[model samples]
Target: MQIGHDAIIIGGGFYGAAIAVYLVRQRGLKRVVLIEREPALMTRASYNNQARVHNGYHYPRSFTTAYRSRINLPKFVQEWPTAVKQDFTKLYAIARRNSKVTAKQFERFCRDIGADIRVADPALRGLFEPRLIEKIYVVKEYVFDATKLARLAEQELRQAGVQLIYDTSVTAVSKGVDIPLQVALHNKQGVQELLTSQFVFNCTYSGLNQLSGDFSGVCSGLKQEITEMALMQMPESLCGLGVTVMDGPFFSLMPFPSCGLHTLSHVRYTPHMHWSDQRGIDPYEKLRGYHKETRVDRMVRDAARYMPELLKAEYKESLFEVKTILNKNESDDGRPILFEKHMDLPGCYSVLGGKIDNIYDVLEKLDEVI
Candidate 1:
């Protein structure tokens, strides 16, 4: 069977849901349908992330990404006031050894980006190990409750008159000789076709390669990796604050406001292993899923070096998700959101964002394209 729509979004994550709302409400586009393989939105990488609404401090190495984040941080807060947590203070500490940026450089970077940065309070400063950490600053960063964000997105999509289809996957995409594009969707029933009207957005995240071979064959810009995050309980003193040790193999322990638990994620230790599709083989082919006990042990062990309090935290669980990252000049640190319009195929667009707050950048770019 073939279904027709004015616009079809291939992913129903927060970015895709936001785009669907924008296209229908802001652009006055009717007959839009958003399809997702999962039963609900934000269950994948969107929900299984660090949840920090980044404000340039995390990516001092990439100025474009940092500045874009700084620009969008407030816009996101203003738009989703109910979904974000700003009452808690966020502390960013620079690593003494294997540091990416020095104390002066980090301060200058934040100042240049107009980010609110200052020395941590003397009482709060003692929480980190002085030997491993060089400097700590209180930055303007907050965590977004993915559950609240998803609920808000669902309401927005509904009010915007978007037809959201869950438990559906876009297995194949092909350009029609006469029609704009033909998408093959699979589910429990069988395969169905969706004929779009000259505009289609591929927001499938890690499922990009599964949708089209051309993305990996001709366009060749995206790189996929399996990443993990560990969740644990936090002590009372650390409940109202979030801490991150910068550079090299460090960790970020932040309170998950939604569940009242803390998440400890190590930059280099959390991901049990990472394999790339660009390595002449597919990584997901060999990998099954996340190993909870091993990854959690590594997370607590590595995080203990900076915050010994993590040693007392009880292990909750670990989440594994396929992270779709942009291959920017062979560097894995770029966070600039990617929105490719008809790179290899007309009437088709691919969207991949690094940070959640960068959703504004994605919407702005989509408005320009649509």
Candidate 2:
């Protein structure tokens, strides 16, 4: 079967869905179809992440990223007020050794970004080991409920009349002789095709390299990491609080709004491993021989050094997924959203973003392209 639309958005995550909504409601483009390989939306990196709406504090290494996040954080919260948790008091601590940012540097970065930051109470600082943590600050950052956000997106998409096609994957993309681009899609019904009038947006995130394979040298700078987000049941006092250690090989234990639990992720101890090639990824094949939790004990051991309370938390299951990150230098830990327009074929663009709040940035960039 063959279908036609004004635009075809690959990957029905927040980025793809938001683009569809914008095209229809704001841009006046009709017949936007969002395609997702999963039977549901936000099943990959979108749902599996820490869900923190970055407020410039996470990227003390990248001032541009921190500043941009500070600008978009409020926009996102205002857009989906019900989907975000405003109750949590986020705690950010600078590591005493091997930290990426010094206490003063981090504070300076936060001040420059115009994000409010204050010292953690002296009594509250007693919860952490003095040798492991040098300084702590209470920052204004909140976690979004992934499931709620997805639901809100669906409602808005429906209201905008955006066609969402789940359980469908784009198998191939080719510049059509008649149409601008022809995208091959696969599902239970079998292979099909979609011809777009405007352009094809590749918002597949980690699947960008795989989806744009036929376009040579398009996603060459892309890399993938097999990362794990450990879910733990913590005390009530820590339920809504978020904690992240600064610099180096540290761990961030933050509230997971969707599951109502805390997610523990390490900077050095996490990332089971990273794989990068100009070619596409086969995550299942790559992880076939690997046990997801084999190294989780080590992660917990390392994280315990900073937050001893984590040792007392009950181990719930872990969510493991392949995260797509830009291949950048060590000094540059910033995650700037990537937007590649027409790598080799016209009327086709590939997009990848790290954080959900960055979706606003993605939409603004798309506006200029359109």
Candidate 3:
């Protein structure tokens, strides 16, 4: 009963943790080891996700990572029916004519995947609260509860009998003949090396460069930033356009079943943190001049420009947080990389670059590899 495992799952976030659960349930691997740098699971990107179960609204722009991920999300959400406390009627996506994927392309996207979406502007309820957007006409779509999905996944993994260790930090990893991979961690008892089996599932967002003896490729090169905001009233659908305005950047408005919240962010560059292997985020102190404030202001301001209602809405300072993300693209082959070998890494894998929209897809991959 007390043994390493057929898998060594690195990182205790959504993708890694969920893969551990799926491997145990689907592959029936009881003896397993989980290494999490944080004191608990899902303290990373998983918790920082938009918490929106994206409705396959953003699909394959030439089979891009975002598009490819669209294929497996429904199953991911269906896996945990109870964890999901909310989902919108539909997901709306709007794009400016000059964007990478245009209106016509988006329509074809709906037809290609048979994804449930439409071209009409749905009423904003909840934070969808009756607003000034009544007059603005922009291409719109919807998304779902990604955070809920993660919460559900965590519950399911536990029910399926998986042991998760938190507050444990991985100092290094190595591979040899007798022990294919050795994961050294900082536990209460002091430094200890875990002899992991090969099937290592790495769901560590922005922290995948630890594998040693020829697995350093696990850490891909890309920058990521995530900012989360909670909105009081919510609506049935999320609508707005992914656009590049005068400043030349991309932005989107994400609607949730109302974490009693909402979020807005863009995939851009900032010289904050490059390497994903850093620990403990630097807390921001200023109300408006801080890092969190800068990011949120950028997000909400862009969203307000897209959705007219967001322009006049009163600001509520009590509901917002910034979550750093794995910033990169699947186009340059910058996806999560993990090495799987039974008795080699045990249950271990690496989740490289992703958003809440694509993490579920990564989980499914871990299931098969493990």
Error of 3 at 367 (Å): 6.4
lDDT of 2 by residue, 1-370 (tens): 4556789889988888888899898789888888898888777778988888889898887888888898899999999999998897899999989886899998888878889999999766877899879999999998989999889989998899888888888877777756777787888688566554557888887777665434543543877788887888987656667898887788888888898888888877568888774444565456555677645677789887887777777778888878778887336788788888875778788887878888888888878977
**Superior by TM-score: candidate 2 or candidate 3:** 2
Best by TM-score: 2
Task: List the pairs of residues colliding in candidate 1.
Answer: none
Residues 1-370, candidate 1, lDDT per residue (tens digit)? 4556778898888888998999998888898889998899988878878889888888878888888888898899999999998899899999899987898999998889888898998878888788988989988888989999999999999999999899888776777556667777787578565554567888867665556533333254666666777777777667778998886678888777667777788887666654455523443343454443457787788778887777778877776767767676346376877777765567688887777888888888877877
lDDT of 2 at 7: 90
Give one digit per residue, the lDDT tens place, for model 3 in 1-370: 1234577777777667666776787778876667787666665556544554444454344345445555555554566555453433333434343355554656676667555544345443223323322221222233444455556666776787776777776665666445455566677667565555655565555545434444553333434333444342323223332222211244444554435455554555222233333333322211123444334455566555555455544434423333433344434332333333334344345564345545555555655664
Better of 1 and 2 by TM-score: 2
User: If the candidates were sorted by their TM-score against the true structure, best first, what order would they fall in?
Assistant: 2, 1, 3
Off by over 4 Å in 3: 1-3, 64-67, 85-98, 121-151, 188-193, 196-198, 211-215, 224-250, 267-291, 314-349, 353-370
Of candidate 1, the 10-residue stretch with the lowest lDDT total is 278-287
